[model samples]
Target chain A: MARKALIENDALIDRLSATFREVGYEGASLALLSEATGLKKASLYHRFPGGKEQMGLEVLQEAGRWLGNHVLKPLAGEGTPRERIAAMTSELDSFYQGGRQACLLNLLSSPIGEESPFKATIRQMFEAFVEALASVIAEAGCTPAVARDRAEHGVALIQGSLVLARGLGTTKPFRKTLDVLADELLADLEARA
Target chain B: MARKALIENDALIDRLSATFREVGYEGASLALLSEATGLKKASLYHRFPGGKEQMGLEVLQEAGRWLGNHVLKPLAGEGTPRERIAAMTSELDSFYQGGRQACLLNLLSSPIGEESPFKATIRQMFEAFVEALASVIAEAGCTPAVARDRAEHGVALIQGSLVLARGLGTTKPFRKTLDVLADELLADLEARA
Candidate 1:
């Protein structure tokens, strides 16, 4: 799977992200990483001097930042809360390839994900995701507790659908879940209005 | 990690299950499988002629049947739908260890899981799970379509909560998702009654 094209740093991170998202932390051996990114083992070691541990941390950080910029920030942006939610869903949809893919966070958090030294980083990614969703709901005028609960619930559904959709061999479950999520997101704001 | 105790066939499967649940398909090398199952690589090959592929298919089937008997059969068993859903939830909670553990299907279906020959087996597992839940819901008096939708939604929430709960390092979200699922499962029946 190695490409002959010149690979930039960001491209390397993206390649690493794709590999990690598919095979997970422990499964992403140097051989697979080399194949995925078209980098030699020495090249990877040079790029990530700390080796797999550093590579994992960097990839997790990169995915987290991508979500923050592409998904969360838009939800917490200044448009109407409903509009913001819509934008956020689109961001998530694109990031996940409309449920055709697993979340990098979930992929990374597999058994190796749990055992990795980067566990805290994974936890932080989820907390930030939850917080971002909560902020939007709170702005929509629900009590803080209610808003937080909704955010947690929404995240859980989205995560579960990926498992189900993939398990069931259909994206319909995921697409339907998104529709339900859209409805759930605006329920409070519409109620208050 | 090979244990010295006499390992029953079921015990060996459980050990293999735990390893698969932890390291995933590609990550679970013969050496690791040997360590997990207390079998020499030659012994494992003798037991499973198809090697890792056979081992994976066997493990996935074992897990699927466990879910059918413990989770779905109870849900579709003789009882009120509420009672049935309750039974299913209890089985799921025990299986997941209150969100402290990840699902084997989820663990397996990482990139390698999809690429593995067991993909259809995984799909069948979900289809059966969905059907089992839908039967209980429909018997409670909803139309088949509505019951199916509710079952799908309920499964998605439960599945999503596992991801969220594991990611956030807490079981509260998973526990709460169960509550919501209970409500959703009976909502139509309760409304009609």
Candidate 2:
């Protein structure tokens, strides 16, 4: 019985993440979450008694961890700068396309006209992303300050590309923008070389 | 009487554009818009018989024109490349801060879950932005391809900065990012020099 409950908890988290990615926090109501998870409202309440806020926080933290391990870590690994950047860009494209989702940070941060408990968590996630990327760029031969700037630029590119992709209603531009940004960053490194 | 009606129509467009900038298209309902404009729903409907979609399209078009004239035109004007870039960056910061809003293109493009007329208009607005920025970069002594790339980068910076600002709940970083981007773009041009 305990094992079954764990499995159900995992399922609920996955479903809640997907729904939040699609509709944002305020937009995702208990009714919608219940329908998406194939669980009744009462059952969802049983798992997340704090309700949608609790679910949203869990989903965001999970996403942050996953993105850190999958996207940022690999890029910060030991590799030639060019290879590392290519890997990072490829990973981003795959994650976005495979998930068929926009950036969770952007969705969560949008001015939905209310204060969300998730905002601070989302901001911290981005700060971590910038720090991780900065470390990688510094390894690639940029000065610490330059690496920080490059990392900020890269984050801006990805975040903006997601907005563009969402606006264009297609992922092609998003993928293309990432590719372009990767090339630009690598070229800047080469010039320093 | 006709002149008075024309003035009222213009005011409605301005109010609607302001409202859209504050809240995204999906979140900005007719009720909110009516409240923002201090006009009843009946007056709003009288002005925009086709309802939110029609009003949204007009707001988008008006905002697009404002961006082109106020933001893009000055940057593309005759000045030293460094001067022109600085001017453009300052203009963008002021425009965004003055409105206390995110880019309308981004707001319109974000999903309310799929196919909608606003999508096409947003795409058109982006293309216009790209073209205008490209022209300026081209004028600043870059190859056409490089100019296009720079233009796209500029758009990405602006859009991403807004997201960052919203996430952090402050406009300072947004303004700072644009300043950094302008400096980067100028540095690239100087390297070529």
Candidate 3:
């Protein structure tokens, strides 16, 4: 019974996250959230005592955890730097569903207050992502500074491609960027070879 | 008096656009919009008879006009491809206010319906932007296809950097990307030289 409850909770979060992604924070009204999750307002309140803000915070937390597991952990796993990045890109393709979805981070960030706890959560998530990618690039024999630079650039490319994909109504830009990411991040190592 | 009214109208749109940039579409409630424009709700409705949707449409149209004049027109101006791009980059730097501003295109696109009139407006704006950049790149010795690809990539870089800047509360990524943009877009020309 405990295991079933945990699974149900996970499904609920996924539904809530999907609604947030589709309509953004301001658009995700109580009516819509309840509709999406098939839960009454009172039940949702029971689950997330602080309401939508708490739900958003939990969604961001889950996203960070997802990235850590799917992206950062693999970057630290056993493989060449290029291989690790390539592997990670495939997972990103899955995470983004091949660029059909806009990023929740980009969508949700604009509505929150400057002092909102979400800001720190998001910044830390990007920082950790960059750090993990930097370490992998460093393993490719670039200096720490260069690796850091490449990592930041890689993150920007990924984020930017999603924006383009949405604006232009095509996934070509995102898919093409991913194809080149491994090489772009490890150009120094490639040049040596 | 007529000129004064026109100027005030422009300023009003600017205020509305800034509000959209800050909080996005769903977040830009009637109360908030009234606050941002310093107009009563009825006055806003008087100006934008279609209400928030109309205001959002006008904001997008104004943005496209601004981009055409500031970015595309300059790209087609009589200067070397590299010089044109540099000047345009400077304009962009000011337009984005040194990356302290989040992009309205990225922020405003999320909440509107998929079939929203705003989608076509946004897509056309980006397409025009990419086409202008591609022309400049082709003038810098890249083939037509290559120019288009580079242009798309360049747009992604700029858009992505803004996302990073907003999330990290730092303009370094945006500034760094702009600094390298001319060279990155004109590498083929430089290589020939």
In candidate 2, which residue ranges exceed 4 Å CA deviation? A2-11, A26-35, A40-43, A80-85, A98-100, A110-114, A180-193, B1-11, B75-77, B80-85, B98-100, B182-193
Candidate 3 residue pairs in backbone clash: none
Q: How do the predictions measure up, each by TM-score? A: 0.90, 0.82, 0.94
Q: Model 2: what is its DockQ?
A: 0.40
Superposed on the true chain A, the predicted chain A of model 2 yields a TM-score of: 0.88
Order of candidate numbers by DockQ, starting with the best: 3, 1, 2
Poorly placed runs, candidate 3 (over 4 Å)? A1-7, A111-113, A191-193, B1-7, B111-113, B191-193
lDDT (tens digit, per residue) of candidate 1 on B166-185: 77878889888776777767
lDDT of 3: 0.86
* lDDT, candidate 2, at B57: 90
Second chain alone, TM-score for each candidate: 0.88, 0.86, 0.93
Task: Report the C-alpha lDDT of model 2 over A65-130, residue by residue, as the tens digit.
Answer: 788887778877867777777777788877777225777787767563456687789778878887
Q: Write the per-residue lDDT of candidate 1 for residues A1-193, one digit (tens) a residue.
A: 4655368889999999888877677778899999999989998997899999899889888888898899888987778778888888888787877788788778777552356676788888889888888888888888889889899988887888888988887787888878778677557376654
DockQ of the candidate models in sequence: 0.56, 0.40, 0.58
Point out the worst 10-residue segment of candidate 3 chain B by lDDT: B1-10
User: Each candidate: what lDDT?
Assistant: 0.81, 0.74, 0.86
For each model in turn, which proportion of the native inter-chain contacts is also found? Answer: 0.73, 0.42, 0.57
lDDT of 1: 0.81
On residues B35-146, what C-alpha lDDT tens digit does candidate 2 reach at each position? 9888888878888899998898999888877878876777767776677777777887777772257777866664635677787788777777777777766766778888
